[model samples]
Target: MAFRPLGRRAYGSIPHLPGSRTGPADRHLSPALARTLTQRARDARDHVVVLEKLDGSCVAAARVGDSLLALGREGQLAAHSANEARRLWATWVARHAERFLAVLRPGERVVGEWLALAHGTRYALPHEPFVAFDLMRDEARSPWREVTERLGNAGFVLPGLVHEGAPLAVEAVMERLGGAGFHGALDPVEGAVWRLERRDAQGVRVELLAKYVRPDKVDGSLLPENSGRPAHWNWRPEAPPPPPEMS
Candidate 1:
């Protein structure tokens, strides 16, 4: 259940992002994806859904057989992770295991942000700390509409919805979000994720996923390593739980 990295944005680049280079191989958007984001999608069935990108640790709850396991970015058992943030994330996952198990099917995973520790932006989160953005099976992602309906129905707080329907410019999307985002971010949002979807007789196809990170946004500004200060926490569990049992 190793996480697949979200493709880089076709637009602006974050200073710290390795893939934000101008090389040909670093072009994150495919031809179809580029077309869809700039102008109307070629097919009538195609549409775009953009979600506000959060500054937090990426985590997932994967269904392994009958049990749900909390995983870090590289698919390591998060409960055993050397990183404190991931360990805390595992505890949070355990406290809310039933919610993940209720929504995930066999071999499926709910990938999202773990905001217990702030990265660049600190949050006074209005909802749960874990905010799911994708319902995935291996490298394949579920359609945006399905992801929203399914995860939303199961009490998952997803990233803020910036826009839906026709292709929109980054400036336009930012204007729509105003200054702060939906999840109660204290500072300006990092950026937005763009998911392109198309429906046909075969069902919904998740064409491509891209993101736009603000050029001026500093990476890990709130983190202890970056700031040379104490760690900044967005949320914390009441008590640290025992290490989770793993298969």
Candidate 2:
């Protein structure tokens, strides 16, 4: 699997939007307030798709020769660091690697979330611990339907789809996350991830894939917690830079 790239913060503003504010970190916005409000680039779509933005470690798994290698955003972690979720994922990948290889072209990676023990529990999941989010081919994104169907057919639980229609405003999507899933079932979901489904001569790729997190029901830090044990290398979740922070 290929490493994930960063999505420079979504420069446009949405009222009450809590974007990627991190270490030194993504803390404040921009060098100056005026620049953030006027200069940052923002994307707006007529139709928006929002999936449950899960709280877990970013996982990338692939089939290498005869072994199934599980990786974090940074690099491969040892058996102990990988946790149960990742080990289970590696097994799943081993079982279905050939099935996925048959369909994927070249340079495509299966991006997902490993939720064995990251943040405290938020959702009621009793199925496979890891959930597939997207199929990435270099910088381009594949359509959501294609990614989920392929994995779902393999008897896996795909990420929950919240909204898939004309322009669900960012604020509204955030509002719904606090309550239930699409079917009105009470689920303590983290937040919603928004992406535009656009097709071109090349094919379908996820565009402006962005996230909106709920402070009340989500982990404040993006990184997974550690056991306070020291290691030679630290593990960090790899992701495209957050959409340019909306001023």
Candidate 3:
């Protein structure tokens, strides 16, 4: 499928700077183009899937020459800073470069999320790990399913998918968030993205995508509701509710 340029403002009004390759695999930092939430009702007869939204930042992994480059979502050279988390990620890629390359073709790029706490943030974890949720290739189509399989084979933990026909409502999403066995918190997120399988004008396979942020997180605050004020950032995991007793 041909790649259709995102709506002029769909990715924000930031003019494309020269020498910058804004391919789908590249991550940008346009707050104006934050992910939006979806209002589509779940179909009772169609399959629906739910995934745990990790509260980490974004990262991109690509095969650069004989090595791999791991970049932050904002297109920063992550290892330049004295951040220990960044160093750890760099080391991880170096150690696992061979495994990643087995699935990645030359010049291909893979997008993943990097979850870590910044300096002075109380939400810091003991270690830094990553989870890949998207992938892109240079010569071939974006094989998302293949990417997931490759990552799984490499022993990486990918997000889970729920398949059901029931419509996914905010309440349902919240319930999934509060369920047990997940590692992340249930704080308001930028929102979820819906991927639609379709072809573009060039007859190339592409995904019609949309993003939705929670009403509260829209303003860049972590508040549960948009209260028109800055709220404290909480990363502590909430205890799951107890199971109901037999009637």
- Per candidate, the number of residue pairs that clash is 0, 17, 15
Q: What does candidate 2's lDDT look like per residue over 173-209, in tens digits?
A: 6566666553222345556666666555676655555
lDDT of 1 by residue, 1-247 (tens): 4333222111122221222223333346655555576566776798888889888988888887778788776667787866778988887888788888889898888888989998989889998889998888877889988888999998899899988898877777777777788989899888787778888999988877777777687778888888999998889776755554565
Give the range of the ten consecutive residues with the poorest summed lDDT in model 1. 8-17
All candidates: TM-score: 0.85, 0.62, 0.55
Mind giving the per-residue lDDT tens digits that candidate 3 earns over 1-247? 3222221111111221112224444343333222211234322222233444444556666775666776555444455434445545555666677877876766666666555432111232332356666666542435345656777777666654532233345444545544321444334333343343333445434333333334343232333244444433332223312332444
Q: Alpha-carbon error at 35 in model 3, in Å?
A: 15
- What global local distance difference test value does model 3 have? 0.44
Cα RMSD for candidate 2? 10.6
Question: Which segments of model 3 are wrong by more than 4 Å?
Answer: 1-50, 82-84, 118-128, 138-143, 163-171, 179-181, 186-191, 199-204, 218-247
Candidate 1: Cα lDDT at 236: 79
Better of 1 and 3 by TM-score: 1
Where does candidate 2 stray beyond 4 Å? 1-23, 27-47, 64-67, 77-88, 95-106, 178-187, 217-247
Estimate the overall C-alpha local distance difference test score of candidate 1. Answer: 0.77
On TM-score, the leading prediction is 1
Looking at model 2, report the run of 10 residues with the lowest lDDT sum. Answer: 7-16
